[model samples]
Target: MIEGRVWKYGDDVNTDVIFPGKYTYQPLEPAEMAEHAMENLDSSFAKEVKKGDVIVAGYNFGCGSSREQAATCLKAAGIAAVIAKSFSRIFFRNAINNGLPVIELEDGVDDMEKGDTVSIDFEAGTVTHKGNAYHFPALPKEVLAILNDGGLIPHVRKQLGRE
Candidate 1:
């Protein structure tokens, strides 16, 4: 179970806006990458985001180029999870591989507002907002394992007995 404060947004939030294309070429550390998260979409986001904050967005969230940094930057920015009405397939996979939990809540987005407190139970596949619970398909065990181990690379390293 993960609970956090919401940082809401609308549909079609692309990779560039999630983590601007200009800084993509730089050899930025995770913290540095976080500093630029949502600079394009919400200039105040990087500065105001707190650890364990959640992002609640509308349909086609993450609809843009398949840059892994889009997911990476959000995770680095201390986003515990992203709850959207829908997601770009590539971005969805990238998020899981990067240890960022992306939950698809087709309903209840309208009920949630910025700064609202929300709770997500991955095991039960429910998102509780303001005492109401919305459901989504539970994540598969394999995907959960990857997220639990902190992304694909870390999971693989552990599987190979390297960590």
Candidate 2:
């Protein structure tokens, strides 16, 4: 179960805005990457985002170059999960690989607004907000394991008993 305050956005939020391209090549750490998360779209996000906050967005939520930094920065910024109407194919996979819980809530997303409190039960595929429950397909067990282990690399390491 993941519960948090919603940080909402609209469609087609690309990588450049999520994490500015200016610092992409720099050898910044996770914390540094977080400092710039959503800097272009929402300048206050990095400074104000709290741990376990959820991002609710519209269709094509991550629609841009497959920069892994996009997902990495959001995770480092303490985004617990992202609920969107749809996602770009590459960004969807990248999010999973980064241990970010992303759900495709085709309906009821519009009912949510910024600063609204939401709760997600990944195993149940439900996003609860303001006494309303929105449903999406539950993620598979393998994917859940990866997220549980904090991402693909960690999950693989644990499976091989090398953690």
Q: Which candidate leads the pack in TM-score?
A: 1
Q: For candidate 1, what's the RMSD?
A: 1.1
The digit string of per-residue lDDT tens for model 2 on 113-155 reads 9899999987677889989898899777887788789888998
Error of 2 at 140 (Å): 3.2
TM per candidate comes to 0.95, 0.94
Q: Which residue pairs of candidate 1 clash?
A: none
Tens-digit per-residue lDDT, 56-112, candidate 1: 999998888888888988999999999999999999989999999989888899889
RMSD, each candidate, Å? 1.1, 1.3
* Residue pairs that clash (backbone atoms under 3 angstroms), model 2: none
The TM-score of candidate 2 is: 0.94
| Per-candidate local distance difference test | 0.91, 0.90
Give the Cα error of residue 94 in candidate 1, in Å.
Answer: 1.3
Candidate 2 ranges beyond 4 A from true positions: none
- Each model's backbone clash number: 0, 0
